[model samples]
Target: MRTLIPTLLFFVLASHCHGQVERDKALHFLGGNLFGLAGAGIAKQASDGNRIWTFVGSVAGSTLIGLAKETVDAGQRENGWDNDDLAATVLGGVTIGVTIDLFSKKDDKRRLRGRYSKLDLKKKKQFLQPTSEFVVLEGKLPSLNTLGLSNQQFVVE
Candidate 1:
């Protein structure tokens, strides 16, 4: 629900730039989205799920790619650089980055809540306790006697 507004706003701004529609801007926008997604994935893996790095990586990647494309276009004789194209690319990046950051933050909050909710000793003990399932055949498993179950009552299979 929170993401819908920003997404709609991005499209509205992108479509209505300078009161004219530019078909070339769509390619730039799609390119930015692709690069931004790649950057977000790389950042998430490198930063161990850090939201800041993920957001930064996404925006930076898109902006940098857009800048590079504009620079190249400026050097050409027939094809010139367009700010609107670059803006569209950057907007795409911002949209993706914001969405990723929002989702990641929600996940972080959920994890935090889960951690705090497991503060009870009984709950912790139950969570940490091993169940009566064993697959190892060569090594000795932890004693079940300490858990109030006799060794004879335990089955190897």
Candidate 2:
């Protein structure tokens, strides 16, 4: 009975700690998404070469961030069941990040914002837009535009 009490206390503490880490990681991913959005446009604007490099660097940065995220996730997994907090954080961050990129267009930010605002992430296994040409005024979404679609949906892995 004495040993069992201590074991219960230890588990309670461990679970609390794990929950905190998971929450933190989710927030971090959400932040990264916002950062990526802003930086991606600036990178694109610098110069064609610089733009390419920026994207490359951003991808690397994102990968590193994901690694960091997974490490944090492992901790939570060790404690208890997976929670939605992590996904919420990543999605929140990505929404802001992608929006930042979308809004960066000098001429078409307003116009695009109107169309962009109409998009809904709730769709499953679908591309965001049916036709995506001119996502921004001048910028490109080759996949969206060439395919003549706007909204794109993604399958959750």
**TM agreement with the true structure for every prediction:** 0.55, 0.30
- What candidate 1 gets wrong by more than 4 Å, as runs, is 1-20, 104-157
The residue ranges of model 2 lying beyond 4 angstroms of the native Cα positions read 1-26, 34-64, 75-86, 106-157
lDDT of 2 by residue, 1-157 (tens): 9899999999999888777666566565665565455444444434332424445434444544555566676779464323354454345545544544454443332312222233343445754767644454357445654566654464346
User: lDDT per prediction?
Assistant: 0.74, 0.50
lDDT of 1 by residue, 1-157 (tens): 8999999999999767745656688789888998887777666665556677778888888999999999999999999998999998988888888877665444543321112122333332434766776555468655677557888966788
After best superposition, candidate 1 residue 146: deviation in angstroms? 61
Instruction: Give the top-scoring candidate (TM-score).
Output: 1
Candidate 2 total steric clashes: 19
lDDT of 1: 0.74
RMSD of each: 13.1, 22.6
